[model samples]
Target: MTYSRSQDSPDRRAEFPQTDLRGSIDGLLNAFYQGTSKEAARYDLTTHEFNLLSACLKRKEECTATELARVLPVDASRISRIVTILVDRGLLKRRRLPSDRRVVMLSLSEEGVELTTRILRRINRNSARLMEGIDEDEIHIFTSVVSRIVTNHDAIQNSE
Candidate 1:
C-alpha cells in the first residue's frame, strides 16, 4: 500500500492577515525589548537598569525614587528592582534626605557614570548602523509620524 500526504496539511507560512492587531503590537514590543535587553546585557546591565541610568542622566539634579518612577515609563516596583541592583553593583548611590527620611535620592556613582557614558557610545554606534540607509528627512518624518500616533492614542484615552 502507498501512503499519500493530505491536501489539507497545515500551511507553513505566517498567517499575518488572520492575526490580531494587538498580537502584532505585542510581538513587535517584545522583540524590541529583547533586542535592547541583549544590548544592555553586553555592558553588564538590564534594560530597566539602563533606563534608570538614562533618566538620571537626563535630569538636571539628583532624582528621588518616586520622581524616577514618575519620569520613567516603567512601574515603581521595576524602578525599585533596578535601583537595588545598581546599588548592589556599586554603580548607584542612594541616600535618605535629612529633611525627609522617607525620600531616597539616587545618583550615579563614579563607576556608574563611566559605565553609562561607555554604553551610550556603544548605543550611538549601533543606532548609526541601523540608520545607515535612512536619510535625515526620512528620519524626521518617521519621528513626526510616531509622535502623532502617540498623541492620537493619548487623545483617544482622554476622550473615553
Candidate 2:
C-alpha cells in the first residue's frame, strides 16, 4: 500500500487507499498477540509483564523506568505498577543507581532471564511455523516494508 496526502488538507491529512493491507496487518498482529498471551500465561504472567521482561532481556544492561517507558507503549504509571509486581515476584530487580540516588535501575533477575529465554524459544518456533512456506526473499521484502511503515508512523507522530 502507498501513503498519500489528502487534497482536503495537505499539511494535516494523509490517506492510505482502502486495501487488504489493514486487514492483513490486523490479522497478523492478532495472531501474534494470541500466541504470546498463551505462552505468557504458562508462566503466570500477563502480556504486559511478559513484554516488560522481554524488553529488559533485550537491554542487556541496567536501564531506567524512563528508558522502558520510551520503548513500551504503556504510560509511566503502568510501567511502575508492572515493575512493582515483577520485583515483588522475584522476576525483576530494582535498585537505586549510585550515581543518581533518586533514579531506580531495572534489570531482569535470573528467573526472569530463564523465563524470557524459554518464552522466546517458543515464540520463535511459532514464528517459524507461521513462515514455513514463505521464502527468505519474501521475508526480507516483508520486513523492509514493515520497517518503512514504522518509520512513516514515527514521522507522523513526531510531526504532530
Candidate 3:
C-alpha cells in the first residue's frame, strides 16, 4: 500500500536524466542566493558591492579601475561608479600613479581590508556548510560539472 518516492513515479528519468544536472545546479544556486544577500546585508553591503570588493582583493598590487572592470567583466562605467562610491565611503583608496599621473590606481582602504577579510571569511564558512554532507569524491564531481558548465557558457558567450 505504501510506495517509496522513487518507486511511485520514476518514469520521468526516461525523458529527463534522473539527476537533472543543470536544473539541480540552478536550484541549488537559487536557494543559496536567497540567503546570501541577507548575509551581506549584515555588514551594510549589497551582494554586488561585496562582490566588487572581493574582485579588488584578488590582486596583490593596486589595480586600476580598468583592471577591475576587466576582471569583473563589466562595463568600465559601472566599475567607475562603484569605485567612486566605495572611495567616498572610505572603503577604498584611489590615487594617481606616481610615475604616470594620468593613470589612477586603487587599493582597499585600511577599513576596506578589514571588512573584506570578514566578508570573505563568512562566505567561506557558508560554502563549507553547503558542502558539509557531501564526501570528497562527490565534491570533486560536483565541481567538475560546474566547471564544465561555466566553460561551456563562456565559450557560447564568446561566440556571440
Candidate 4:
C-alpha cells in the first residue's frame, strides 16, 4: 500500500492510500537498512565487513570464502577481497582443507572475535535504547511481518 500526502502539508502529514505491496516494502526495507548502517557506523565497521564477521560468528565452524560468497549477497570478487584483507589484518585465518587441498577455510581470530562481540553488544544496546518506548505488541507484529517476508524471499531464491 502507498502512503501519500497532499501538497499542502506533505512534510508533516501524509494520507494513506491504497498502493501495491512492492513500493511500500521497498521503502521500508531501504529505510531499515539505512538506519542499520548508521548504527553500525559508530563502531567503525564497514557494513560489508560487519556482515562478513557476523556471518562467520554465526557459522561457528570453518567457513570457506565460497560459502561466505554464497551466504552473503555480495559478488565473489568482493568477498575474495574482503577475505584477503581480513586474513592480512589477522582478523580471520586462512587454511587449506585437510579433506581437499584445493579448498581453503576461514575462521575468526581471537582479536576478530573480541571486536565483533563488542560491536554487536554496542549495536544491541543502541537498538534497545531506540525501542524503549515502543509497544511490545507492535514490535511483535512488525517482527512477524518482516520474518514472513524474509522467509518468502529465501524460499524463492532456494527454488531458483
Clashes of each: 0, 0, 0, 0
Q: Estimate each model's TM-score.
A: 0.74, 0.88, 0.79, 0.75
Across 1-117, the per-residue lDDT of candidate 3 in tens digits comes to 432335534676556664555456667877677556767789888776777788878786798988887777578987888888889889989999779999998999889988988
For residue 62, model 3's alpha carbon misses the true position, in angstroms, by 1.4
Candidate 4 residue pairs in clash (backbone atoms < 3 Å): none
Q: What is the lDDT of residue 102 in candidate 2?
A: 100
Weakest ten-residue segment in model 3 by summed lDDT? 1-10
- Of candidate 4, the 10-residue stretch with the lowest lDDT total is 11-20
**Ranked candidates, highest lDDT first:** 2, 3, 4, 1
Over 4 Å off, model 4: 1-44, 158-160
Per-residue lDDT of 10-128 in model 2, one digit per residue for the tens?
Answer: 33433543335765787788889999999999999999999999999999999988899999989999999999999999999999978889999999999999999999999888978
Q: After superposition, how far is residue 75 of candidate 1 from its true place, in Å?
A: 1.8
Model 2: which ten-residue window has the lowest total lDDT? 4-13
lDDT of 1 at 31: 60
Best by TM-score: 2
lDDT of 4 by residue, 6-105 (tens): 3335433345332334556677666656656775577666778778988998899988888999889899999999888787778889889788999998
User: What C-alpha lDDT do the candidate models reach, one value each?
Assistant: 0.77, 0.89, 0.79, 0.78
Query: Cα miss at 76, model 1 (Å)?
Result: 1.0
